[model samples]
Target: MKLQQLSLFLENRPGRLGAPLEAIAAEGINILTLSLADTAQFGILRLIVREWDKAKQVLEDAGWVVNLTEVVAVDLLDRPGGLAEALKILEAANLNIEYMYAFSLRRGDKAILIFRFEDPDRAIQVLLDNGLHVVDGDELMSFVP
Candidate 1:
Protein backbone atom coordinates (compact mmCIF):
# COMPACT_ATOMS: atom_id res chain seq x y z
CA MET A 1 0.00 0.00 0.00
CA LYS A 2 1.24 3.49 -0.94
CA LEU A 3 0.07 7.08 -0.77
CA GLN A 4 0.95 9.88 -3.13
CA GLN A 5 2.66 12.70 -1.26
CA LEU A 6 3.05 16.06 -2.94
CA SER A 7 6.39 17.74 -2.41
CA LEU A 8 6.14 21.44 -3.11
CA PHE A 9 9.28 23.55 -3.15
CA LEU A 10 8.66 26.90 -1.51
CA GLU A 11 10.89 29.88 -0.95
CA ASN A 12 11.23 31.18 2.58
CA ARG A 13 8.94 34.11 2.09
CA PRO A 14 5.75 35.18 3.81
CA GLY A 15 3.26 34.03 1.18
CA ARG A 16 5.20 31.14 -0.22
CA LEU A 17 3.30 28.55 1.79
CA GLY A 18 -0.01 30.27 1.27
CA ALA A 19 0.12 29.92 -2.50
CA PRO A 20 0.09 26.14 -2.44
CA LEU A 21 -2.66 26.00 0.14
CA GLU A 22 -4.63 28.50 -1.87
CA ALA A 23 -4.16 26.48 -5.00
CA ILE A 24 -5.35 23.34 -3.31
CA ALA A 25 -8.34 25.11 -1.86
CA ALA A 26 -9.19 26.63 -5.22
CA GLU A 27 -9.09 23.19 -6.77
CA GLY A 28 -11.35 21.95 -3.95
CA ILE A 29 -8.79 19.39 -2.84
CA ASN A 30 -9.12 18.20 0.71
CA ILE A 31 -5.77 17.97 2.48
CA LEU A 32 -5.60 14.98 4.76
CA THR A 33 -2.17 15.54 6.21
CA LEU A 34 0.61 18.12 5.84
CA SER A 35 4.06 18.90 7.13
CA LEU A 36 6.50 21.68 6.33
CA ALA A 37 10.22 21.07 6.58
CA ASP A 38 12.01 24.37 6.34
CA THR A 39 15.54 25.58 5.86
CA ALA A 40 17.13 29.03 5.97
CA GLN A 41 16.00 29.98 2.49
CA PHE A 42 13.37 27.49 1.47
CA GLY A 43 11.06 24.70 2.54
CA ILE A 44 9.41 21.56 1.30
CA LEU A 45 5.67 21.17 1.92
CA ARG A 46 4.66 17.55 1.91
CA LEU A 47 0.98 16.87 1.62
CA ILE A 48 -1.52 13.99 1.39
CA VAL A 49 -4.73 15.08 -0.25
CA ARG A 50 -8.07 13.73 -1.46
CA GLU A 51 -7.15 14.10 -5.14
CA TRP A 52 -3.48 13.56 -5.83
CA ASP A 53 -3.47 14.05 -9.59
CA LYS A 54 -5.73 17.08 -9.53
CA ALA A 55 -3.79 18.75 -6.72
CA LYS A 56 -0.52 18.19 -8.57
CA GLN A 57 -1.87 19.71 -11.76
CA VAL A 58 -3.29 22.67 -9.88
CA LEU A 59 0.04 23.41 -8.24
CA GLU A 60 1.99 22.98 -11.48
CA ASP A 61 -0.45 25.20 -13.31
CA ALA A 62 0.24 27.91 -10.76
CA GLY A 63 3.99 27.65 -11.61
CA TRP A 64 5.03 25.87 -8.48
CA VAL A 65 7.68 23.15 -8.46
CA VAL A 66 5.82 19.99 -7.49
CA ASN A 67 6.68 16.33 -7.38
CA LEU A 68 4.84 13.18 -6.41
CA THR A 69 6.37 10.50 -4.21
CA GLU A 70 4.98 7.18 -3.04
CA VAL A 71 5.08 6.90 0.73
CA VAL A 72 3.97 4.01 2.90
CA ALA A 73 1.32 4.80 5.51
CA VAL A 74 1.41 2.30 8.34
CA ASP A 75 -1.19 1.95 11.07
CA LEU A 76 0.40 2.53 14.46
CA LEU A 77 -0.89 2.66 17.98
CA ASP A 78 -1.04 6.17 19.40
CA ARG A 79 1.26 5.55 22.30
CA PRO A 80 4.88 5.18 23.34
CA GLY A 81 6.95 2.58 21.48
CA GLY A 82 4.35 2.37 18.78
CA LEU A 83 6.78 3.90 16.33
CA ALA A 84 9.62 1.83 17.76
CA GLU A 85 7.72 -1.39 17.13
CA ALA A 86 7.13 -0.39 13.53
CA LEU A 87 10.74 0.63 12.99
CA LYS A 88 11.94 -2.62 14.45
CA ILE A 89 10.06 -4.48 11.75
CA LEU A 90 11.73 -2.36 9.09
CA GLU A 91 15.12 -2.75 10.71
CA ALA A 92 14.78 -6.51 10.73
CA ALA A 93 14.26 -6.36 7.00
CA ASN A 94 17.28 -4.02 6.63
CA LEU A 95 15.08 -1.33 5.12
CA ASN A 96 16.33 2.19 5.66
CA ILE A 97 13.84 4.91 6.39
CA GLU A 98 14.75 8.16 4.65
CA TYR A 99 12.06 10.18 6.40
CA MET A 100 8.78 9.78 8.22
CA TYR A 101 5.89 11.78 9.67
CA ALA A 102 2.99 10.87 11.92
CA PHE A 103 -0.61 11.99 12.15
CA SER A 104 -3.80 10.83 13.83
CA LEU A 105 -6.15 8.99 11.53
CA ARG A 106 -9.93 9.27 11.32
CA ARG A 107 -10.03 6.25 13.52
CA GLY A 108 -8.86 7.73 16.81
CA ASP A 109 -7.22 4.67 18.23
CA LYS A 110 -4.71 4.35 15.40
CA ALA A 111 -2.05 6.65 14.03
CA ILE A 112 -0.89 6.96 10.44
CA LEU A 113 2.84 7.08 9.80
CA ILE A 114 4.00 8.07 6.34
CA PHE A 115 7.44 6.79 5.55
CA ARG A 116 9.88 7.33 2.71
CA PHE A 117 12.27 4.46 2.52
CA GLU A 118 15.20 3.33 0.43
CA ASP A 119 13.00 0.65 -1.09
CA PRO A 120 9.27 1.26 -0.78
CA ASP A 121 8.05 -2.00 -2.32
CA ARG A 122 10.38 -4.05 -0.18
CA ALA A 123 9.35 -2.13 2.89
CA ILE A 124 5.68 -2.62 2.11
CA GLN A 125 6.14 -6.34 1.62
CA VAL A 126 8.11 -6.65 4.82
CA LEU A 127 5.48 -4.79 6.82
CA LEU A 128 2.71 -6.81 5.20
CA ASP A 129 4.43 -10.10 5.95
CA ASN A 130 4.74 -9.02 9.54
CA GLY A 131 0.99 -8.29 9.66
CA LEU A 132 1.47 -4.50 9.75
CA HIS A 133 -1.43 -2.81 8.01
CA VAL A 134 -0.47 -0.42 5.20
CA VAL A 135 -2.94 2.01 3.67
CA ASP A 136 -3.13 3.12 0.05
CA GLY A 137 -3.61 6.62 -1.39
CA ASP A 138 -7.38 6.47 -1.41
CA GLU A 139 -7.64 5.04 2.08
CA LEU A 140 -5.11 7.51 3.43
CA MET A 141 -6.98 10.45 1.93
CA SER A 142 -10.10 9.32 3.67
CA PHE A 143 -8.34 9.62 7.01
CA VAL A 144 -9.35 12.69 9.04
CA PRO A 145 -6.61 15.02 10.29
Candidate 2:
Protein backbone atom coordinates (compact mmCIF):
# COMPACT_ATOMS: atom_id res chain seq x y z
CA MET A 1 0.00 0.00 0.00
CA LYS A 2 1.06 3.58 0.76
CA LEU A 3 2.37 5.53 3.72
CA GLN A 4 1.13 8.93 4.76
CA GLN A 5 3.97 11.44 5.07
CA LEU A 6 3.92 14.93 6.61
CA SER A 7 5.96 17.65 4.99
CA LEU A 8 6.60 20.85 6.92
CA PHE A 9 8.37 23.91 5.66
CA LEU A 10 10.53 25.41 8.37
CA GLU A 11 13.01 28.23 8.81
CA ASN A 12 16.67 27.41 8.63
CA ARG A 13 17.42 28.43 12.21
CA PRO A 14 18.19 26.86 15.52
CA GLY A 15 15.56 24.60 17.08
CA ARG A 16 13.40 24.70 13.97
CA LEU A 17 13.58 20.95 13.64
CA GLY A 18 12.62 20.37 17.26
CA ALA A 19 9.43 22.39 17.00
CA PRO A 20 7.61 19.84 14.86
CA LEU A 21 8.89 16.95 16.91
CA GLU A 22 7.74 18.71 20.06
CA ALA A 23 4.29 19.26 18.65
CA ILE A 24 4.10 15.64 17.57
CA ALA A 25 5.26 14.50 20.97
CA ALA A 26 2.52 16.52 22.62
CA GLU A 27 0.05 14.46 20.66
CA GLY A 28 1.84 11.24 21.70
CA ILE A 29 2.89 10.47 18.16
CA ASN A 30 6.00 8.54 17.26
CA ILE A 31 8.15 9.25 14.23
CA LEU A 32 9.01 6.18 12.15
CA THR A 33 11.28 7.72 9.53
CA LEU A 34 12.20 11.20 8.36
CA SER A 35 14.06 13.15 5.66
CA LEU A 36 15.07 16.79 5.79
CA ALA A 37 16.10 18.93 2.82
CA ASP A 38 17.15 22.52 3.22
CA THR A 39 18.15 25.60 1.32
CA ALA A 40 19.84 28.77 2.49
CA GLN A 41 16.69 30.32 3.94
CA PHE A 42 14.22 27.48 4.51
CA GLY A 43 13.98 23.74 4.95
CA ILE A 44 11.46 20.99 4.33
CA LEU A 45 10.92 18.37 6.98
CA ARG A 46 9.38 15.16 5.76
CA LEU A 47 8.25 12.68 8.36
CA ILE A 48 6.53 9.30 8.62
CA VAL A 49 4.92 9.32 12.02
CA ARG A 50 2.34 7.26 13.91
CA GLU A 51 -1.17 8.74 14.23
CA TRP A 52 -0.99 10.70 11.01
CA ASP A 53 -4.21 12.66 11.59
CA LYS A 54 -3.37 13.73 15.10
CA ALA A 55 0.20 14.60 14.20
CA LYS A 56 -0.95 16.80 11.35
CA GLN A 57 -3.54 18.49 13.56
CA VAL A 58 -1.04 19.15 16.30
CA LEU A 59 1.47 20.69 13.90
CA GLU A 60 -1.15 22.89 12.26
CA ASP A 61 -2.50 23.94 15.63
CA ALA A 62 0.98 25.04 16.59
CA GLY A 63 0.99 27.41 13.59
CA TRP A 64 3.05 25.29 11.23
CA VAL A 65 2.20 24.70 7.58
CA VAL A 66 2.03 21.04 6.64
CA ASN A 67 1.12 18.87 3.67
CA LEU A 68 0.29 15.22 3.22
CA THR A 69 1.86 13.00 0.59
CA GLU A 70 1.52 9.32 -0.20
CA VAL A 71 4.75 7.37 -0.37
CA VAL A 72 5.66 3.72 -0.81
CA ALA A 73 7.20 1.82 2.11
CA VAL A 74 9.05 -1.31 1.08
CA ASP A 75 10.73 -3.95 3.19
CA LEU A 76 14.51 -3.81 2.73
CA LEU A 77 17.30 -6.15 3.56
CA ASP A 78 19.86 -5.03 6.12
CA ARG A 79 22.84 -5.89 3.96
CA PRO A 80 24.93 -4.57 1.18
CA GLY A 81 23.50 -4.38 -2.37
CA GLY A 82 19.97 -4.76 -1.01
CA LEU A 83 18.97 -1.24 -1.89
CA ALA A 84 20.75 -1.38 -5.24
CA GLU A 85 18.75 -4.46 -6.23
CA ALA A 86 15.47 -2.71 -5.49
CA LEU A 87 16.62 0.35 -7.37
CA LYS A 88 17.52 -1.84 -10.33
CA ILE A 89 14.00 -3.22 -10.37
CA LEU A 90 12.56 0.26 -10.46
CA GLU A 91 15.11 1.36 -13.01
CA ALA A 92 14.23 -1.53 -15.27
CA ALA A 93 10.63 -0.36 -15.20
CA ASN A 94 11.63 3.24 -15.93
CA LEU A 95 10.44 4.44 -12.51
CA ASN A 96 12.05 7.61 -11.29
CA ILE A 97 12.85 7.95 -7.59
CA GLU A 98 12.25 11.43 -6.31
CA TYR A 99 13.45 10.82 -2.79
CA MET A 100 14.03 7.99 -0.35
CA TYR A 101 14.88 7.36 3.31
CA ALA A 102 15.60 4.34 5.48
CA PHE A 103 13.72 3.02 8.53
CA SER A 104 15.06 0.51 10.98
CA LEU A 105 14.26 -0.47 14.55
CA ARG A 106 16.73 -0.93 17.36
CA ARG A 107 15.91 -4.59 17.93
CA GLY A 108 14.76 -5.64 14.50
CA ASP A 109 16.69 -7.26 11.69
CA LYS A 110 14.57 -6.13 8.78
CA ALA A 111 14.55 -2.54 7.52
CA ILE A 112 12.06 -0.41 5.65
CA LEU A 113 12.76 2.15 2.97
CA ILE A 114 10.35 4.96 2.21
CA PHE A 115 10.32 5.98 -1.42
CA ARG A 116 8.74 8.82 -3.32
CA PHE A 117 8.37 8.09 -6.99
CA GLU A 118 7.07 9.94 -10.02
CA ASP A 119 4.58 7.13 -10.64
CA PRO A 120 3.82 5.43 -7.35
CA ASP A 121 1.11 3.09 -8.62
CA ARG A 122 3.29 1.68 -11.34
CA ALA A 123 6.25 1.51 -8.98
CA ILE A 124 4.19 -0.44 -6.49
CA GLN A 125 3.16 -2.92 -9.13
CA VAL A 126 6.75 -3.31 -10.26
CA LEU A 127 7.98 -3.89 -6.74
CA LEU A 128 5.22 -6.40 -6.05
CA ASP A 129 5.89 -8.19 -9.29
CA ASN A 130 9.51 -8.42 -8.23
CA GLY A 131 8.45 -10.06 -4.92
CA LEU A 132 9.10 -7.08 -2.67
CA HIS A 133 6.84 -6.46 0.31
CA VAL A 134 5.12 -3.11 0.36
CA VAL A 135 4.13 -1.94 3.84
CA ASP A 136 0.79 -0.32 4.51
CA GLY A 137 0.38 2.84 6.59
CA ASP A 138 -1.67 1.10 9.23
CA GLU A 139 0.83 -1.72 9.51
CA LEU A 140 3.64 0.79 10.01
CA MET A 141 1.71 2.57 12.77
CA SER A 142 1.51 -0.55 14.88
CA PHE A 143 5.14 -1.45 14.27
CA VAL A 144 7.02 -1.85 17.56
CA PRO A 145 10.65 -2.37 18.43
Candidate 3:
Protein backbone atom coordinates (compact mmCIF):
# COMPACT_ATOMS: atom_id res chain seq x y z
CA MET A 1 0.00 0.00 0.00
CA LYS A 2 1.08 3.56 -0.59
CA LEU A 3 0.17 6.96 0.83
CA GLN A 4 0.55 10.37 -0.73
CA GLN A 5 3.25 12.58 0.82
CA LEU A 6 3.60 16.34 0.50
CA SER A 7 6.97 17.94 -0.06
CA LEU A 8 7.54 21.68 0.03
CA PHE A 9 10.28 24.25 0.22
CA LEU A 10 10.76 26.26 3.39
CA GLU A 11 13.28 29.05 3.63
CA ASN A 12 15.94 28.35 6.24
CA ARG A 13 14.87 30.91 8.77
CA PRO A 14 12.74 31.20 11.85
CA GLY A 15 8.97 31.62 11.20
CA ARG A 16 9.20 30.47 7.55
CA LEU A 17 8.28 26.98 8.62
CA GLY A 18 5.45 28.18 10.82
CA ALA A 19 3.50 29.75 7.96
CA PRO A 20 2.91 26.50 6.07
CA LEU A 21 2.30 24.51 9.24
CA GLU A 22 -0.20 27.06 10.37
CA ALA A 23 -1.97 26.89 7.02
CA ILE A 24 -2.36 23.13 7.32
CA ALA A 25 -3.52 23.47 10.90
CA ALA A 26 -6.09 26.09 9.99
CA GLU A 27 -7.59 23.63 7.54
CA GLY A 28 -7.87 21.06 10.36
CA ILE A 29 -5.42 18.63 8.77
CA ASN A 30 -3.25 16.48 11.00
CA ILE A 31 0.35 15.80 10.12
CA LEU A 32 1.06 12.17 10.70
CA THR A 33 4.85 12.28 10.38
CA LEU A 34 7.38 14.65 8.89
CA SER A 35 11.08 15.08 8.10
CA LEU A 36 12.96 18.28 7.48
CA ALA A 37 16.35 18.46 5.74
CA ASP A 38 18.05 21.81 5.39
CA THR A 39 20.74 23.29 3.26
CA ALA A 40 22.38 26.74 3.32
CA GLN A 41 19.42 28.59 1.85
CA PHE A 42 16.33 26.45 2.30
CA GLY A 43 14.91 23.22 3.68
CA ILE A 44 12.70 20.48 2.29
CA LEU A 45 9.74 19.47 4.42
CA ARG A 46 8.35 16.01 3.73
CA LEU A 47 5.05 15.45 5.45
CA ILE A 48 2.40 12.77 5.54
CA VAL A 49 -0.89 14.19 6.63
CA ARG A 50 -4.39 12.85 7.25
CA GLU A 51 -5.67 14.63 4.16
CA TRP A 52 -3.27 15.13 1.28
CA ASP A 53 -5.10 17.32 -1.27
CA LYS A 54 -6.42 19.81 1.23
CA ALA A 55 -3.03 20.15 2.87
CA LYS A 56 -1.31 20.74 -0.44
CA GLN A 57 -3.93 23.28 -1.45
CA VAL A 58 -3.35 25.29 1.69
CA LEU A 59 0.41 25.39 1.31
CA GLU A 60 0.36 26.18 -2.39
CA ASP A 61 -2.31 28.82 -1.94
CA ALA A 62 -0.15 30.43 0.70
CA GLY A 63 2.67 30.78 -1.89
CA TRP A 64 4.60 27.68 -0.92
CA VAL A 65 5.70 25.37 -3.73
CA VAL A 66 4.18 22.03 -2.84
CA ASN A 67 4.53 18.65 -4.50
CA LEU A 68 2.64 15.42 -3.96
CA THR A 69 4.38 12.05 -4.06
CA GLU A 70 3.82 8.43 -3.22
CA VAL A 71 5.38 6.81 -0.19
CA VAL A 72 5.04 3.43 1.51
CA ALA A 73 3.86 2.99 5.07
CA VAL A 74 5.05 -0.27 6.56
CA ASP A 75 4.02 -1.81 9.84
CA LEU A 76 6.75 -2.90 12.23
CA LEU A 77 7.09 -4.10 15.78
CA ASP A 78 7.79 -1.35 18.26
CA ARG A 79 10.93 -2.82 19.72
CA PRO A 80 14.67 -2.79 19.48
CA GLY A 81 16.02 -3.87 16.09
CA GLY A 82 12.55 -3.95 14.60
CA LEU A 83 13.57 -1.48 11.94
CA ALA A 84 16.75 -3.40 11.21
CA GLU A 85 14.68 -6.51 10.62
CA ALA A 86 12.47 -4.70 8.14
CA LEU A 87 15.49 -3.25 6.38
CA LYS A 88 16.91 -6.73 6.08
CA ILE A 89 13.85 -7.84 4.16
CA LEU A 90 14.08 -4.95 1.74
CA GLU A 91 17.78 -5.58 1.34
CA ALA A 92 17.18 -9.19 0.41
CA ALA A 93 14.63 -8.07 -2.16
CA ASN A 94 17.17 -5.63 -3.62
CA LEU A 95 15.05 -2.63 -2.66
CA ASN A 96 16.67 0.63 -1.70
CA ILE A 97 15.05 2.95 0.80
CA GLU A 98 15.79 6.54 -0.13
CA TYR A 99 14.62 7.76 3.28
CA MET A 100 12.20 6.97 6.09
CA TYR A 101 10.45 8.42 9.16
CA ALA A 102 8.26 6.89 11.83
CA PHE A 103 5.17 7.36 14.03
CA SER A 104 3.05 5.20 16.32
CA LEU A 105 -0.63 5.13 17.18
CA ARG A 106 -1.71 6.15 20.66
CA ARG A 107 -2.17 2.60 21.94
CA GLY A 108 -0.38 0.11 19.71
CA ASP A 109 2.92 -1.56 20.41
CA LYS A 110 3.79 -1.03 16.77
CA ALA A 111 5.57 1.65 14.81
CA ILE A 112 4.47 2.93 11.41
CA LEU A 113 7.36 3.86 9.15
CA ILE A 114 6.88 6.10 6.13
CA PHE A 115 9.38 5.17 3.41
CA ARG A 116 10.52 6.85 0.25
CA PHE A 117 11.82 4.32 -2.23
CA GLU A 118 13.19 4.47 -5.74
CA ASP A 119 10.20 2.41 -6.82
CA PRO A 120 7.33 2.96 -4.43
CA ASP A 121 4.93 0.39 -5.90
CA ARG A 122 7.64 -2.22 -6.27
CA ALA A 123 8.73 -1.65 -2.71
CA ILE A 124 5.22 -2.27 -1.51
CA GLN A 125 5.02 -5.47 -3.55
CA VAL A 126 8.32 -6.73 -2.20
CA LEU A 127 7.36 -5.92 1.37
CA LEU A 128 4.09 -7.79 0.93
CA ASP A 129 5.78 -10.79 -0.65
CA ASN A 130 8.13 -10.90 2.29
CA GLY A 131 5.25 -11.02 4.80
CA LEU A 132 5.50 -7.42 5.91
CA HIS A 133 2.30 -5.55 6.55
CA VAL A 134 2.05 -2.57 4.23
CA VAL A 135 -0.39 0.01 5.52
CA ASP A 136 -2.66 2.36 3.55
CA GLY A 137 -3.72 5.97 4.03
CA ASP A 138 -7.06 5.14 5.64
CA GLU A 139 -5.37 2.79 8.08
CA LEU A 140 -2.92 5.51 9.06
CA MET A 141 -5.69 8.02 9.66
CA SER A 142 -7.29 5.62 12.10
CA PHE A 143 -5.39 7.09 15.03
CA VAL A 144 -5.49 10.76 14.15
CA PRO A 145 -5.94 13.18 17.04
TM-score of every candidate relative to the true structure: 0.92, 0.91, 0.92
The TM-score between candidate 1 and the true structure equals 0.92
Clash number for every model? Answer: 0, 0, 0
1 against 2, candidate with superior lDDT: 2
lDDT tens string, model 2, 24-109? 98777878778998999999999887778889989999999999998999987778998899999999999999989877562265
Top candidate on lDDT is 2
Clashes of 1: 0
Cα lDDT tens digits, model 3, 20-138, are 88899999887878889789999999988877898988888889899988999888888999899999989988998888887545337778788999999888888888888988878
Question: Which 10 consecutive residues of model 2 have the lowest summed lDDT?
Answer: 102-111
> What's the C-alpha lDDT at position 18 in model 1?
82
Q: What C-alpha lDDT values do all the predictions have?
A: 0.85, 0.86, 0.85
Q: Mark the regions of model 1 whose C-alpha exceeds 4 Å error after superposition.
A: 104-106, 142-145
Name the TM-score of candidate 2: 0.91
TM-score of 3: 0.92
Better by TM-score, candidate 3 or 2: 3
